[model samples]
Target: MPHSLLWSLVLAVHIISIALWIGGIFYAVAILRPSLGLLDATQRTSIMLQTMSRFFKGLTHAIPTALISGWLLILHEGGFANAPWTVNAMQAFGIIMAGLFARLYFGPFQKVRRAIRPQASAFDSIRTQMLIIMALGFLAILSACLSHPFV
Candidate 1:
């Protein structure tokens, strides 16, 4: 493929990934999280775990694509040291978001997965963690949107 095509593909993947990340967070926060409060622990926990697993899978695939495309954009535009403050800030924010994502994946997510396989009582804990991660993800996306790195 031509370089432009490759870059276009990367941009498409990045945009889609951001949408998935942001949309998943929005759904979880605005819908699933609230609805979960009404369900019994067993049902709520099980559902939450399942939903989270699916979201995480998408996130796992998306993050790398977003990072690579974002990095390429940065390099093609200008190296980090030469980029404008807004561009530099966007990259910095992305790194922070990535770190938070990693923590969510390796930390609370793993704990929830391990704690609540068969137990319904563990649903509360799962719900709590999910909300925390969802909020953080939402904030990160908001930051990226407001930053407007593409401009």
Candidate 2:
């Protein structure tokens, strides 16, 4: 109803979406991957598949929400031409991160799902892509911070 409240809600949605997507990736790479290494190949692939499947499904929803909320924030601040450089950079980074995630999901992840015994490379590929995405996410956050004037 109120202008400030609407902006706050949109910002909250954007932040939560980013956290869900990037934080999940961080968990998978930093936590789950290592935990899987302790298991045998069969167990590793099985658990990795199950975990990734759920993560990907959740991200399927998060990604769009993040994008849309980001756009809303941009519009609230003013359209792209009127927005600051940092906002534009964040938009670029967000799009790139989304693209990378889509590639990982459709490419190596598909092979992993179909293989009877997926190789370590498949998992490594996924991790590498996720790391890249996470880094981009950090950059986006940094850009958002930069847009704020420092006291």
Candidate 3:
């Protein structure tokens, strides 16, 4: 829509970054977490902690790329007022999602990782939070799709 090579590249990068971050969450929720039931508590905790550590590492890059590129795209279209409601919704959801992730990383995530024998309650909370993030991610995707005039 911006009709520029830069815009297209930025858009691609933004989409890819978000896909990696949220897609990882989905995998953890749907595939990884579910399959871990057979393992003992220690094994599950160790595996999940390791998985989350790497995932969060990737998020450190993805979040910034997605946010910055999104802002650039917004500015390209003549700033906030000129951008569609869907874009605004996406931005709001993205920011909230990032904030939520940070909170969990520093709070429950850290708590469980440092525990000698982490409680099941901690992982349950994290799972709930992940579900919320996943739902928000879906909402953002829906907002983006609805941006299409034909939609």
TM-scores for every candidate against the unseen true structure: 0.76, 0.96, 0.93
> CA lDDT, every prediction?
0.71, 0.92, 0.90
Off by over 4 Å in 3: 1-3
Candidate 1, residues 1-151: lDDT per residue as tens digits? 9988887887787778777776776787578878888988778778888998998888888877777788887787667777766556656665666776777778767877887364544445544554665565566556566657565
**Of 2 and 3, the candidate ranking higher by TM-score:** 2
Q: Model 2 segments beyond 4 Å from truth? A: none
Model 2 sits at a Cα RMSD from the real structure of: 1.0
lDDT assessment of candidate 2: 0.92
Q: 1-151, model 3: which lDDT tens digit per residue?
A: 5568778898899999889978989999999999999999889988988998898888889988989998998998799899988999999999999999899888999898898888988899999998999899999889988886882
> Model 3, residue 22: displacement in angstroms?
1.3
For candidate 1, the per-residue lDDT at 65 reads: 76
Runs in model 1 deviating more than 4 A are: 1-5, 116-151
- Minimum summed lDDT over a 10-residue window in model 3 is located at 1-10
Point to the candidate with the largest TM-score: 2
